[model samples]
Each structure stands twice: as structure tokens, then as C-alpha cells.
Target chain A: MVSEFRIRTETESNMAKQSGSNKSRLYVPEPPFRPGDTPDYSHISVPAAHSPVRPDPLCDADETRDHATSLIRVMRFNGETQGDWVPGISPEIKRTALRDIALTRAMDERMFTMQRQGKMSFYMKSTGEEAVSVGHSLALQDTDMIFPTYRQQGILINRGASMKEMMCQCLSNSGDPLDGKSIPVLYSFKKHGFFSISGNLGTQLIQGVGWAMASAYKNSDEIASVFTGEGATAEGDFHYALNFASTYRAPCIINVVNNQWAISSFQGIAAGEGETFAARGTGYGLATLRVDGNDVLAVYAATEWAAERARRGGGATLIEHFTYRKSGHSTSDDPSKYRPESEPDVWPFGDPLERLKTHLILIGEWDEERHVELLESCKKQVRETYKSAEAMGNLSGETRVNDFTMFEQVYEHALPHLDEQKRMFAQERD
Target chain B: MPQMNMIEAIRDALDVKMSQDSDVLVFGEDVGYFGGVFRATAGLQETHGLHRCFDTPISEGGIVGIAIGMAANGLRPVAEIQFADYIYPAYDQIASEAARLRYRSNGDFTAPITIRTPVGGGIYGGTTHSQSPEALFTHIAGLKTIIPSNPYDAKGMLIDAIEDNDPVLFLEPKRLYNGPFYGDPHAPAKTWRGHELGEVPSGHYTVPIGEARKISKGGDVTILAYGTMVWVAQKVAEDMGLEADILDLRSLLPLDIEAIEKSVKKTGRCVILHEATRTSGFGAELAAQVQERCFYALEAPIQRVTGWDTPYPHAQEWAYFPGPKRVGNALRSVMEG
Candidate 1:
């Protein structure tokens, strides 16, 4: 019955990802009790494969091996000691996180400024909720894949991605690594292990699981991490990815940075319980964790643990970091209309950088003089970088914004009529 | 020279191409091990190994998305949708990812992916399992749409689809998958080239994408059809004793309007037929094109004997499809006018 249909392939990106591996056959056992072809469920025929693949381990370091603990383990790991106010992690990683956090925050502020000045069309900020994205991204191995929602650009920011490169991409310049194939928010950097970012709200979650399953089957030991807001967890891909990851033990770490809002809708509207998004993972029989998203140390620890667990073939873990967006959803939004003015003006409340600064001060690892010195130098450097990028000229000089005819990437070999279309473009260009 | 049916020819083409290029892979549901649901890729998994030929999850979007990823990185992938009816679930990926890959990437990356599926219905596939959704894809600028009427063309067109750089939609007529009867396989291996005339190549060859096939030469009436309807139109012409020039459209977008005009110019009359619903069907496009180009050469108005604007009912499939009898009946009406 499976042999009664055919797949039409010609032209473009209709290819499926398969590695060079000989695993178990798709094992289609004969259906013995053949109920008369009456449709069960939405005349939508789901091809059956009852057999599952066994999870395989990866070659790793002793630290990575011992770190085969889920996000929840990391969340609970020093929870008692966390209140003791001792700073965890090396001095260097902390400063680096602090620096990345500051840069991304500045980038957003500048982006909004540019939007107000009409330099670009649109931009989404990583302000306030920086640590979950900026901090956790640093924990990933170079080979690990990250699928970021718009706000998660901070993940790229934290990965040493250049300010100039980010500016060029948003400007859609020729220097943009995405080569104008991407829209502003939906971006992909194949070299950075970033799969194509999707504009469809919850779609990348499923794609992350699929890539992880493929990686697991290939024994690559590479985990796929995808970002979404607390609100996006309500989408089907969240539950679908979690269930698939748990059932197959695919190397996927699902992160929901509970930034408390998806655009204008409050996170509470997404779920009645208001429990951390990570706790939702437990109902699906997988490991889960909820952490202070503002705390860079917490985000890093959770990510490090989840990555190692995935590398060890222990399956997926869900991490929900509690954070807040200090800026609007994008450059065009006004958070003031939605956000209340007052907050508990204390050291431990809603501020990711402040918590780290407090811990640093308590441990005597960081000094106020050093923070002031770094802030002055970093802000100057950021301002200079933006000036240099702006000097490269707008998109019209850097790249042709009108270059829209692009069908060649759909397929490797050219189709006949499309050749004609290309000829037309060549003529127009000439 | 080797001639075969559409399904067997597709398998032979996959085998030949897979053997030729280390990069070419074939996969989808049931495509591995058991071959495709329509057997278009039978024996590929055993012959090519799992990497080059394998089954994927039931997630159609995943199937196409991964295909896009693989193609973007550099691998020629041939993915199958079990049926055209089921392509909607994966529609966004094809439209947003596969088709737009090059345009969006600004030529830095190319998807170079081929999507193969069995489309159209005359077999008792009912509504859900059978549909000619090619129009949905052909309407998309970045896609190339193809439908083969015979084994030789099926093999040639599919290989063309696999080789072409842009996304191609290869539609195999399931009703014609085994060929000319109530429950008979529309395209059995024995009658692979049953509808196709002339010698077929044994080596790697392409029939050229976006080219139409002229099956019969006549001067009185031009019968424009595709997939199983090409053979149906030919059979009807034979039975009706009408000298109908039949054009088998191998490609839809970048449509061979020249071929249609040449036939209609001499024949002075035109008729279009297909199993898809009449409203907004491929026939509608053909009728519109023929009228635009061949209006002055008209002996009569362009006629379309297509499936009525209704679902492909389980009981009345024969009535729904433009069979030989229906084409013959419609041919007389157009010729007389």
C-alpha cells in the first residue's frame, strides 16, 4: 500500500537531510488485521514505523561526561548555596557575559534610535532578557545548532558575532552572510550552526527536534537548541518537540526564556498555571528546570548541564529562565503603554546584570572601579563600531536592495525556463 | 533503447541517476525498502543504501525542511510526497523554503531539490488521496511543474526534474500508475511506455524541462491534455475518427504556448481535458492561454471536458474524470461546432 504513490522532485530546496549512515531499516511489518480501508482519523494517512532507534553516546571530555545532568539538576544543584550569595563560575566567563549583555543592550538601544532616525525598517531588541540568550549561548559547543526567535539575536551577539555583520544583515547589504536570502528577523548562519530562522511563530521548535533526531541518528552528539518566548511555549511545536525528544531521546534542549510577554500579550494568557515553562516539560516525562533568567551564572550553568546531558545521549531537557523585556517587542513598539511603572527596587529583583554585579561585589572578584572602566571603554567601542558600519553607506551602496529575482538557489542545476528568467535579470542588471 | 511505464521508468531513472551522481539521493515515506506508495522509487533503498535512499518521519514539513537544509549545504535530494493530496501540510516549506531559497539567499545558496509526488485521480482514491494541486505550485514563481503521460516521458521528465536547479513538481497520474481500466494498474512495468511513442534512452539524458510533447498530428481539431488525459484524448480521437492534434504538456509554468498555438493554428479548434476540478484547474489556464493566442484561428470556442467543480466522489469517479468516452463525446461537439 505504501508503494502506490510517488514523490515529485525537480528544482529547488525540496531535499531531505540524510547523513551517510546505515542504520536500522524503516522496518514495515505487514498489517495483519487489515481493517477494511475505512479511514481512521483525518483521512490523513500517517505512515507507520513502530520500531524505534536506540540512542548512541558521543566522544566527550571528563567534565562533559560528569556533567550529564539535566537542566533541572543544574537548577537544583547549588540552589541551597545560591542563597549564600557566593558567586559561581570563573572571573573571566562572568566578565565576558557581562560584556556581551551590555553590548546587546546597547545594540538594541541604538537600533531603536536608528529606527526613530529612519535608518532601517525594523528591529527586535534583546534588552533586559539578555542573559538567557547571551549568557546561555556561551555554554554551547561550537558544533551545537541554535534556532533563535527574533529576540534571541542576543545569542548570536554573545557568540562573538560582529556588530558590523549584524548591522549589514539588518541593512541587507552584500556583506551580510545571509546574502539577502533572509528577512530581518529570520536569519541563518550555516557556519555558526544556525539553521534558517523561521518567521512562522512556533515552527522552528519542531525543526530543532528534527535536526536533533537526525544528529542523534548520525551519532554527531550535537544538540539542537531553539529559542522562543514564554508565550510561544503554547504552540504545538513546543509539546511536539518535547514529546518527540523524550520518546526518542533526541539531543535537543528546549529553552523558553519567560520574558513575561510575547509582543503585547502577557505570558499569563499563554498558560493558566503561570508555572515556569520548564516545569511543563515534566508532564511529558522529560527533565525540566526554571531559573532566574536575569542571572548570567544560572543561565550558563543550566545550558552547560543540558548540553552535556544531550551529548551523553540522555535525551532532551526543558529550561525556562525567568527574565523581563525592558524594551518594546521591536523598535516600533511602546512598552510604556503596557508595562506598569513600579517595581520592588531591590538588588535581587528582575535585573540580570545587577544580580551578577552583586555576587561579584560579595565575592570581591569584581570591583566597582573595573565595572566603570569597562562600561566607558565598551560603550565607546560600540559607538565607534556603529559609526564605522554607518560609514559603509546604506544598503543601496553596499548591496542592491532591488535585487529580488533569486530562484537559482532552489536547485543546484538550472531549469530550462528559469534560465530564461535569469537571462531577463542579467539584461535588467546590465 | 529502453521503453518502460511511468513508475518503472521513474525507478530506472533514479537507479541510473543515483549510480551516476554520488550526490543524488531518493527518500520519503515508503520510498525506502517498500519503494514509494506509488512505487516510483522501488528498489532504490536496497540498491543505494540508507544514506542515499531512506524513509523519513510522517512530518511532511520536516521532510521538505530538512531537504531544504541538505540542499542548502550541498546535496542533491529527491523527496517524495506519498500523494499530491497530502502536500498541503508541507506546502509552507516548499513555498517559503524550497522555492524561495535562491531568491531569498540572493544566489549565495541553492536548494537544488526535487519534489516528486503522485497527483491527479481517476482511480478510486476518493477526494483526500487524489488531487491535482499542481496549480497551487505552478502559481508560485520559483517552482517548475511537470506531469508525464507515458513511461518514457515520466522517466525523462522526472530525471529532468531531479537535475533541474529550481524546485520542480513532478506529478504522476495515479489512476494511470498501473493503465486504462477499472482496477488495472495505471502504469504497470510491462506497459511503462504504453502511452509514449519513440525510443527512450538507456543512459543519462534530459528531455529538457518546460517542454511539451506532441503525441498525435492532425489538422481539424487540437486536443490539449496531460497526464492520463493525453492518452485518454488520443484514445478518444481514435474512437471518434476525429483528426485531433494532441499536445501532452510536459511542463505547466513556462508553458509551451507555442506548441498549443501551432496545433490550434492548423487544427482551427481546441479542447482541453483533465481529472482536476474544472474551476481554476490546469484546463482553465490552457483555455485562457489558447484563447489569448489562437483566438483569430478559431473555428470554434476553446472547449474543456474536465471534472465538474465537485469533489472526486468515491462512487462516481468514472463520471468525474474525462475518460475516453467523455473526450470522444466532447470531441464531436467541438468538431461539429
Candidate 2:
């Protein structure tokens, strides 16, 4: 039975004393906590309810206390075995997910080869940040919006964007859906709410806030999730996006994939200790989580919780998926110069795919032959997609058709400048 | 016709348009229940309900971000910034997200949104409320910036802005609101003034974007101005005894250069007046374009009367904005030269 009662703080007068379990105050950590080991991720699981909203920046003590106490729940990935089997992630599905990741990895690998081969201009690999993006995107409602950085093809593949479509985009081919936007692969499914990725850092988070806020204003259950790197957290856009999401209770999930490195800068030296990326969300009175990005289950759970909270209007959630980039920052940067290899070896708990395979085997759900077949099939599919995409033709060469019309779709009636540029391009020599 | 001032004209434009479309919303601090600090949105929330009308946090960044998102997702949101000076914090969202979403998305997404805020100085609002930052927005692509000198176009142009499939920054001239909502920003309405703009077309109609209206047609000289400066130019035109044809530029971006060129070519003389600092004012570009395109039409150099190079002053604001007397002096000097 629920009882109506009030609780007064120890600072209040004794005569105004109140009782009950309300004294079990929780601790909410401030933002930018260190990623490595020490953080009390305990949080008061407030049963999702539409309680009276106390006006913020002037909220009551209870709200402040709630905000202060809600931090990441560090579910240690000590090769654990008790989590749910994420219904529907059958061996076939896992094979598909693996195939998708391999396709993304293959694309990243080949794009670099193409750049070096002087076929394409540039490339950025989604090498190690796959599980968080793929796992989280698959958990979202179909109608939800997706804002991502340049390395989230795993997200697009999982969202059902065909590999041929993505290859067309990366190649800037005439058949590219966004018409040679020269953007990364994931933005191919824009109608599916996957916003185009930006090379400029920390912008998609703000875009996510915009999408989520619009959802709230329109009374829709849809949520918007944005992907960023740990390096981007230092930007003003990150804080600006967070403050907006928390203050308005917008349904946006921020996934800061901490790859432990940002191009040449070690992600370690980017920000000091005790200030994890998840801590950044807590400063704005929102729920947050720091998960083992290598553990698919952990990334899945954190994103699942965040998705539900956003759809249920529990406001926003920030998730930091602790992982490693595993490759050079891009085809252009040399990691060996700054990497110092000591850090990678020191932090290795091994790859996410390997860990998941082990977890599956220990539970008697996976076997060696099945895993081998799965790997071979994934490789086969990646090879096939690349071959077909390669057959589709030139992305950098002169336009073969009126395909430059891709730029024409931006305005309804031709805007004068772009119109002139579009026309000028239309008449240019082959 | 009900007599209304500039603030009511702005609020009425929002109210009537909102009533017609569920997608149109009005949001800003104190705008929901309190009707806004300027009371421009008075009685709107009660009329439209909370979804289409509401107050946001004291975050200009949040306000613009949310609006861009809504616009991208198919909502025509008209967000208000309390003061022009406060828009700096939100400049990122406006410039980066709202302005570029359409272009960056390669036409897959567009921020068909409107940002409304009061600008210009004449009232003693010091540094904060008195700013003319149109040039800042014009420099950013994928954005359509506009300002209205009267309520007739204020309603019509605002409607067009809400309907356009791109982001628009609609700046309201606060000092102009002290009088009629859509009357000449520089003169009281005479029966025959702008008969072409008669009765605001009664029902829903859009004032074409990037077009300028010849508010007062005279052959001697063409005085180009917009927002509050338009009104000042008219008053100065009346005082200088010059046959001035003042063009009220409705849309500043995609800027109705045709109208400016057409007028200048016909008159062979021009004086541009604005309230922004002399450096890179919107008028500077207009003058440059006029000089380039209508180079041979000039009998006199294009004279610009504007706010000094310094930031908006805290005192003698009337002196700061080239009022009728100052504008008159500029017109006289240009004609004499």
C-alpha cells in the first residue's frame, strides 16, 4: 500500500520532521567522468511515471536529488552470463548482424584502398565502433530519427540500407541516392530518418536534439539518436545539445563511442580522469549509462533502456560505449606515429565479436563449426557486395548522365545560385 | 478594418496563420501564457492550445535547434528570440543546423522554419534590443532573411516565410511597432499611399519573396531602405523636397536586386539608409550590386546613411538611427552632389 507522506531534510526544523524510506537519498554524479574503472554507477530506478514536473533551474529538492543520484550503472562485463538472450537474435540474425558489420568493415577497408589507389578522394573507417552503432540502431523504433558521424555504416546496414546503395554513395556514383552528396554510407536511408553524417564534429548531436524536440512538440512517440566520438564531447555543441535535451525533456539518446583515440590525440589526454562521457549527461539532469561496447549485450541493454526511456518520455539518456577504433583514424592519418601500441595492448579485453562468440558457446548456444560457417558466409557476402558495387561504375570520373541533378533536389523551385551552378555543370565538358 | 499597431500585426499574423494551419506554432520564453515580454504573442496560446503554441526554456540554442528539427520533420515553426542581442548564442543552431540541414541533406531534409525577433534601435533599449544583424544572416547560405516595414507585408511575408520550404530569419523592427502594425515604417498612411497594397488582399496571400515595394513613387531620386529605415527615408524624402521613390525591400536575401536596379536605372540617383553599422551593412551589398549592374545609370554616387561603425549606443538612439532629419540631409547632399 502506498502512503502519502512528506520528508524534510536534516536542515529543516525538528517540528517539521517527516518520515519513511524517503531518506534513502541517491547519488548523482556530475558530468565528464573518467572512462577507465572507478565510478559508482548506482542509480535510483524511478519507476517511469509522469509525476508533476517542477519548473527547472528552480526545481524542488526532490527533483534535484533525483537528478544528482541518476548516474551510469556499471554492469561489469567480466565475461558475464545472466543477461537475456535479446529475443529474436537467433544464430541466423547474429550471422546477419555479423555480415553487416563485416560489410561496413570491408567498405571502410576498401575505401582506404581506393583512396590510396587514387580512385576515390578520402575515407574514414568505422573499424572498431561497429557494435554500439549497429546494436543501438536496431533496437530503435522504425520511425525514429538517426543522426550520425561519418563512421556509422553499421547503423545503415542494420537499418536495411542495401550495400549497393551505400557503395554508390561512397563512390559518388551517378546512381548515388543522395546524388553524389559525397557523404558517408549511412545517410543513404534519409527517408528512414537516418540524417546525413558530417565531417564537422559535434553537429549531429544538436541535430538529434532538434529531431527529438520536434517529436515531443508533435506528441509523437518517436525518438532521435545521435552518434559522436569521445573527442567530440569537448565541443560546445555537445554541452549545448545536452542542456537543450535535458531542460526540455526531449527524447534524444546521445551515443558517445569512446574509441580511446581521436586521430592523433589520445582520447585519454583529451579529458582528465573521473569524468566519463556518461557523466556529461548527468550534469544536465538526465539518465545515462557507460557500457562495454565490446559486449554486444551491454551496448544493447544501455541503448534499449535509453530507447524505451525516450519513447516513454522519461527524457533523454547519454550512453558511452567504451571501445577501441582498431584502425587508423582515417585513410589519411598514420596511427603508428602517435599510437604508442602500449595503450591498445594494455586495454584489450579482445574483440566484441570474439567475446560474444565465447559467451554464446559457454551458454551452449554456439559451436565452432557454426561460428566458422558464419564467418565464411559473412566474408562471402562482403566480397560479393563489393564486387557488385565495383561493377556499378565511376564515382569520381566525369558525370555519365544528368546525374548531377542530385544537387537539383535541394530546393523546390530552382534557387538562383545553385540553379546557375547546376546549369553550369549541366553544360560542362565531359 | 480594425486599427492595430506593429506588435499586434505580428501577433495577428501568427494568430491567423496558426488558426489556419495546425503545423504553425509559436514558441519563445514567456510567449505561451505570458504572451511574451513584448506581448507580441498575447492571447495566442489560449487561442491555439499548447502544442501549436508554448514557451521554451531560457535557451535560444534550444529554441532554434528544436525548430530546425520540427521544420525538417514537416512542421512550420515560428520561433521568437526575446531580443536581437540574445540570438548570438543560438547562431550556431541557426547557421549550422537550420541553415545547412537542407543543403547538407542534399534535399532529403529541409528546415522550412521561421525565426522571428525584434531588431533596430530608436527606443532607448540600449545595446541589447537595438541591433540590425541582417548582414550576418545573409552571409550564411541556405537561409532566407527578411524584414517588414509595415503590417500589411508583415502578415503576408510572415505567411510566405512559414509556407516556404527553407529556413527564414524574420526580423521585426521594434520601434515601428510603436504605431500601426503594417503601415509605412516611416510615414502615416495617406488614403492614396501604396494603393497597390490595398486592404492586404483580405484572405490568405503571400507577398512574393525577394521583392521590394515602391512605397512612395517619385522620379527625382530613389531612396532604398527597409524596416525602420524605410520609414525614416520616407520622412526624410518628404522633408528634403526631393521627388523620392522609396522602395521597401521585403526580402533581404535573394535580395530584389531587380527592383533596386530598375528604380536606380530610372531615377539615376539613390541614397541607401539602414540602422546597422556602416561596415558591411545590408545596404553596402545593395549599393555594390547597384553600382555593378546599374553603373551607367548613375548621375550621382550612391549615398549611404547608416548607424556609425561602433556598436549600438545606449543614449541618443534617435541620433543613432538616421532619423528623418539625418536622412533628409543625406538625400539633400546626394541630390546636390
> Which is the leading candidate under DockQ?
2
Each model's fraction of native contacts: 0.26, 0.49
A1-430: candidate 2 lDDT, tens digit per residue: 0011111223334324555766543333222223342322223122123212222322222342332222222222333444232334555555555556655666677667776765455678877667777777767776888888877778877877777777767666655666665454435366666886666688668668877887887788888998889898887778878888877778888888888777876554455434567667766777766665765655665677678777877888777777788878877787766555444444443566666666566656677888788767666776677667656555455424256665564555666656666777878945
Error of 1 at A429 (Å): 12
lDDT for residue A149 in candidate 1, whole number 0-100: 78
B1-337: candidate 2 lDDT, tens digit per residue: 5445567667778877898888898898889999999899999998889777888878787788778777776788899999888999889788877777666667777788899999988667888879989999988877899998776787788888888888889999887665422223344544313333323444576777888887877899998888877766766677667788889887888678778888899999989988899988887888998898888989889999888888787876655767666677778777877
Model 1: how far is A230 from its true place, Å?
A: 3.6
Q: CA shift at B60, candidate 2, in angstroms?
A: 1.5
**Model 1, range B1-337, lDDT digits (tens) per residue?**
6656556777888898899987787778778888877777778888889777887767677667556645654567788988888888788778865676566545544567888888777567889877888778877867788887766777777788777777787888876655433222343533444334424667677777767888778887998887777777776687677777888888887688878889898988999987788888878888887887788999887788888788878777777776666777778888888
Best by lDDT: 2
lDDT of candidate 1 at residue A93, scale 0 to 100: 78
Angstrom error of the Cα, residue A246, model 1: value is: 5.2
